[model samples]
Target: MIYTIHRTNQPPRYRGEWNDTVWQHAEIASIEKFHPQSSAFRPKTEVKALYDDTNVYIIFRVQDQFIKATYTTYQDPVYRDSCVEFFVMPMSPERGAAGYFNVEMNGLGMMLLYYIEDATRTTQGFEKFTKIPQERLRGMTIFHSIPAPMQEELTTPLEWIVEYNLPFSLFEAYLGELRPIAGTRWRGNFFKCGDDTSQPHWASWSPIGEALNFHQPDKFGLLQFA
Candidate 1:
């Protein structure tokens, strides 16, 4: 499964609008491959991506039920709530940079980012991982349909969106200056999860095998930049 990311003439304003002009030109990918561990309830989730000279724009729209979000602080465990994530490896392993960035955000747009070199599970965390500094994340802006600090779960069906733009400079800070993003090929996966929600579920754009893990870079799909 190769997702082709086209270049956008202008960056999208942080509005979380699914059909805005800046996003209409991009292709949409669905997160339909639910993990076996997930509940029977599967929410409809889709993503769109676009790139410009300086940043990459990504947005997720989820038609959800039993929505929940509580963590608001950066680097908090947003995956425990209704979340959407993007794990991207900008540089190929052939270049000796096997690390990838995991951008995890909840419905309220609170996010956690890490550059993971080694994904081996550890008693503490990944064997090799760096939590992205708050200062470096200042360049990114997020827009979410729902506000923050949601403790009560809304059982009614709802549609929500989380959108953000990640500066290329962020990736360069760890992997060194990346070659022109255009025509560059990357490996990545998109995921939707709600570990503590009433209807806990896990789904991905690329089918992750029987293992209920997202850190398997070997299972990532191709991300072709156009």
Candidate 2:
């Protein structure tokens, strides 16, 4: 479903607390269905986002009894574990389009930031699609929770949150230039996947179908700057 991301003049603090006024007012999107559309066991997942001029602030609250994440290094295969992902494609009414960026973080908050030339997860400035250039985002400031490596897989009932302030400059670095004005829309999707977890599941805000591929940008929902 298309989501209108509320514009906030002042985004919420990067802390994990979700009590901020902006979060209270905006509608939270819940991702419940599985990728194949036939799988059962829906996990509790809630996401809220806000965008200002400089950054887009996002928060995710996930509750699951069989959560698992082991990858701690940046750019590692976090999708194999319990992961939350944000794929944003900035658009222009006249220019028509720019590239998209994928910011994926496991439950331990390890992130992999990469720019896609197309829907197939091909990245720029790196020979391998899994390897991202650390030199590009030299001075960009970002934040995430659970910075330390999580040793054990959380099997008990667990509720966790991961928040980030993704800089617009980072998006522009890979996407050329973006002019997000009121009512402008971006093609994107949010995802939670765990290929190697105790309970493997792939859930998304926008349905990804039986392909089980998150790189399908054609099925992405619109994120309007409102």
Candidate 3:
């Protein structure tokens, strides 16, 4: 599965609106596979990505049965709620996908991010996962179609969208400068999970296998430049 990103001269306003002309050209990655071969629900999820010289923009649209968000603070296990994630590794001429980054946001737009060097995830029996302080993410941008502080979970066949921007400079912190010209292949994946919702499920753009895991970088699909 290869996703060719749309290159845009004018970036979107980051308002969770997918009506921008640039987005019309984005290739969609559908999340249809349920993780852990033992599961049965498949919530509808669609994601699109675009990039400019300085930033990579992503948008997500989800059709879910039970949508709930309990955690509002940064890095507070947002994955337990209805969530969408974009994990990416900008290619480098020297080391292949040297390192990757995880940008996860919940239904209410709360997020958790990490620039990983070794794929040693907490699921792989590591202690706690390492993440940059939220203060450092001040430079990043996120926007949700819904207002936050969801006093209660919405279980009425929810449909929502989220849009965010990941500045190229953010990648420079873990892996030096990443300037991918045409034909550069970045290995990454898109994911949707609700570990604590009324009806929990995990889905991915590329199969993450029969086990409950989302840290499989090798399983990531190819993301090529337009």
Candidate 4:
């Protein structure tokens, strides 16, 4: 799907409604959250996105009936808690491998992921880039709050919103001189982890087959730059 931004506006606050069509429209809405049996746990999440000349913006509204997060080293691969993540791949006509960027956020707002590719090498017939920089990573100003007991009672569900702004400059090094042009398409996916379950559910703009993996950009949806 080629998505065009009607305008450049700040993020919108939710008005307490569940409507997928509203999300599918030009406006943003609460994305239907689901849990996959692959992990036996699921969290309710709503996501909305927008794009402009300089960057792409995304907002994720996550609801965790039971909130929990576990922290570890950068590459430790800890999956036992609540966290939100986004994967962005920038595609250029001349480039074979798109620029890979990822962001993962925990309940306490501890974010992790390399925003830039610092090194690359051919490993086992596959090219790999390692040691990306943290400075290249982007983040949201909105912080999730641990709601008070009474507030939790009034709402029944606890929701947290995460916003992001990914700049086009980050792709410059990967693309050399080339840049994303109109009608250009890239692969991407939005994922969430919950309650240290080791299995996280995934929602993507472009659907992959039975096995869900966002690393495959060729299977990603089309993103026509405007």
Candidate 5:
């Protein structure tokens, strides 16, 4: 499973619009492989990615139901809400070295991100991990179709979009300079989940053999930057 990240000379405006001219040329991938534990309700989730000189842009469209979002603070657990996640390893972990980064965002645009060095499951969480400080993400831009702090669940059918751009400098801080990203290769996986929604479900772009885990970097698909 390889997804090409097309080069975009014209950066996206990050307005959460999927049909915009800049996004129309980008290839789309669907997050449809579901875990056996997921409920019968499965949302139609689609993702597209592009890269410019400064940042990597991504957008997610979810035709969903049973939407809910309560966590609003940075670094909070946003996976309990109607959420989309992107896990990427800019550089493969050779031996016990550089690890991957997970960016999880709720439907309302609230996000949780971490730099995980060791993903060994521990009582507190992973054996070794660091929450990417909010300050480092200042250059990142996010857009959401729905307003935030939704404490109540809405079971009606609806479509929501989440879009964001992550500056190359943000990744450079931890993974060193990622300049000349074109022609580069990385490993990543896209996911859609609602842990506490009325109809809980887990879906992924790259199929995961694990029962309910998204930390398997070996299961990630190839990301070819064009």
Candidate 6:
């Protein structure tokens, strides 16, 4: 679950480390033992996150006896195999509504799907959607423990480290304006998937109750900007 600290005055310049200390297994039922239906997948992994003024840093330790990703068509949902993803929704009622920004990574260390737009609309117009360029979206890089292979062994466990420098400019574009303060809270979620499994392991920075939908920003926890 996501841990949040609201700042009424000045937001803390968070340079500390954060991780999933609650559930560290691949059984969603283990997490659901406490969180109920809000749990998404069964991940035998650990993810740590950190943030500064310019960007947020994330590291994932994924343990999979079988890890694989089949590259399908674009915008087809990247959760088909072992992957890590981040979803961010900027909260601003004045700018119509909050939008979604997603970054996904497959086990081959291939980075795909950095999509951003208003949550009210569909991604069908992604190529035509010129609000954010492909360069800016793919600019955020990843430093992986393993590189892509012509063929991969699904029996080995894989670990990955990812770093993202999300420009304030992108946030401004999505929000349709700019602000002075560097600190603010945004609704967000972190997810992972296991290929062909009957159930995929899932978790969020915020507890989303009994519902499995991560699109509900209202259920998101506070992400204090510093």
Task: Tell me the RMSD of model 6 versus the true structure.
Answer: 7.3
Please, what are the lDDT tens digits per residue for candidate 2 over residues 163-190? 8777777766655667587888889989
Which is the winner by TM-score between candidate 4 and candidate 5? Answer: 5
Winner of 5 and 6 under lDDT: 5
- Model 1 TM-score on a 0 to 1 scale: 0.97
Pairs that collide, model 1 = none
TM-score pick, better of 1 and 3: 1
Model 3 lDDT tens row, 25-138: 788889888876423667889999988888888999998767777788887788888899999978887776676778889878898887776765466533334586776676
Give per-model TM-scores. 0.97, 0.87, 0.91, 0.64, 0.95, 0.62
lDDT of 2 at 198: 70
Q: Rank the candidates by TM-score, best first.
A: 1, 5, 3, 2, 4, 6
Regions more than 4 Å wrong, model 2 = 37-40, 121-132, 135-147
Can you write out model 6's per-residue Cα lDDT over 1-226, one digit (the tens) per residue?
A: 4433221232222221123332121112111222344235345554544444444555555655455565533444456656666666656645534456676666544555444543334555343233345555553545555455424435554444433345545666556653323455566666665445444455544556686554555664545444
Which 10 successive residues of model 5 have the least lDDT summed? 89-98
| Candidate 6, position 95, lDDT | 57
Model 5, residue pairs in steric clash: none
lDDT of 2: 0.75
Clashes per prediction? 0, 0, 0, 4, 0, 6
Off by over 4 Å in 5: 92-97
After TM-score superposition, what is the CA distance of residue 203 in candidate 5 from its true location, in Å?
A: 0.4
Among all candidates shown, the one with the greatest TM-score: 1
4 against 6, candidate with superior lDDT: 4
Which pairs clash in model 6?
A: 2-205, 41-200, 41-201, 41-202, 42-200, 42-201
For each candidate in the order shown, give its overall lDDT on alpha carbons.
0.91, 0.75, 0.80, 0.51, 0.89, 0.48
The lDDT, on a scale of 0 to 1, for candidate 4 is 0.51
Model 4 lDDT per residue over 1-226, tens place:
4344332443333332223333343443333334243344455665565555665665677766555544534533333446676666676677655456656665545566544343233453225554446555453243444322121212234676655556666566456554555566665556666534334455444455565444555554544454
